[model samples]
Target: EDQVTQSPEALRLQEGESSSLNCSYTVSGLRGLFWYRQDPGKGPEFLFTLYSAGEEKEKERLKATLTKKESFLHITAPKPEDSATYLCAVQAIGSSNTGKLIFGQGTTLQVKP
Candidate 1:
């Protein structure tokens, strides 16, 4: 079965702190891996999408990288505005051709100034 797992269910960081969030997944076949940021009571905001291993994308203080079995979100000097629940999801081209998506529980990040 395909599944996704995220580490450190919660994270606390000071105003200038930098850290990485891990998203590990297992799928029969990979279509793409996506990253999203969700604020309380709001829907997820798209961050990045990686198509294959060695692919990477960046936006502002966030950088996302992908590998064969996992992906990572690197936050550099995050600010209070960056605090949110980061979500990781994967799309698989299953035998049914439905392109099903599997999501991780997500990591809640808190940035204290």
Candidate 2:
């Protein structure tokens, strides 16, 4: 079974403080890794996609990178507006045709101004 684990289940940051969130996983046949940001009571919003080892993507303060067995979401100098639950998910090769994402529990971030 493909499994994902995220560290530091929750984070409290002073505004302008920078940090990185980790997403580690194991899968049968790796296809892709994804990152999303979710606000309370809202669905996740797509952030990035990593397709291979050394592959990376970034948007604004969020940057995502993938290795053979794990991925990381690096947040630089976060603001109060950046506070949200960050989710990590994966798509295993040959797992299904339905485009389902196996997700991690997520790391909730709070940036206090």
Candidate 3:
């Protein structure tokens, strides 16, 4: 069965510390992988979309990369403002254009100043 899993469940980093969050997935056919950031009591914010192995996207302190079986979200010198829950999700070809997504459990990051 297709599934997604994220590691560490939670992370705590000192201000200016860098770290990486992991998301691993298995699916019959991958259409896209998406990353999102959610703060408490708010909807998730779109971060990146990876379509194939070796694809990457970046925004400020965050860089996302995709491989056959996994993806990574690398944070560089994160600040307290970067604290949030990071989510990874995947859409399978079998879902057609309905945009159904299978989401990982998420990794909550806390950056302390």
Candidate 4:
């Protein structure tokens, strides 16, 4: 069975603190690894797409990387505005791209000013 799980259901960080969130996945075939940031009451915003191990993508203070078995989202110098839920998803090659995503519950981050 294909599945994804994220650690630390919630995180509290002081402004300027840096931390890393963990994402563990198991799938029959990894077609793509996706990372998204979701704010309250809104759909997830795409952040990165990693295809192979040792691959990474970054924007602003956020970085995402994928490996053979897992992925990670690292936040550097987080700010209050950065507070949001981080989600990780995977797409399998057998799927029909019908917008079905196996999502982790999400890691809620809170940065205090």
On lDDT, the leading prediction is: 3
CA lDDT, every model vs. true structure: 0.95, 0.90, 0.95, 0.91
> How displaced is residue 93 in candidate 1, in Å?
1.5
Q: What is the TM-score of each candidate against the true structure?
A: 0.97, 0.95, 0.96, 0.93
Question: On residues 1-113, what C-alpha lDDT tens digit does candidate 3 reach at each position?
Answer: 88999998999999999999999999988999999999999998999999999999999999999999999999999999999999999998874547788999999999999
TM-score of model number 3: 0.96
> What C-alpha lDDT, on a 0 to 100 scale, does residue 74 get in candidate 4?
93
- Candidate 1 per-residue C-alpha lDDT over 26-63 given as tens digits, one digit per residue, 9 for 90 to 100: 99889999999999999999999999999999999999
| Number of backbone collisions per candidate | 0, 0, 0, 0
Q: Report the alpha-carbon TM-score of model 1 versus the true structure.
A: 0.97
- Model 3 residue runs over 4 Å out of place are 95-97
Clashing pairs in 1: none
lDDT of 2: 0.90
What lDDT tens digits, residue by residue, belong to model 4 across residues 1-113? 88999998999999999999999999878888899999999999999988888999999999998889999999999989999999999887675655467888899999999
- Model 1: which ten-residue window has the lowest total lDDT? 93-102
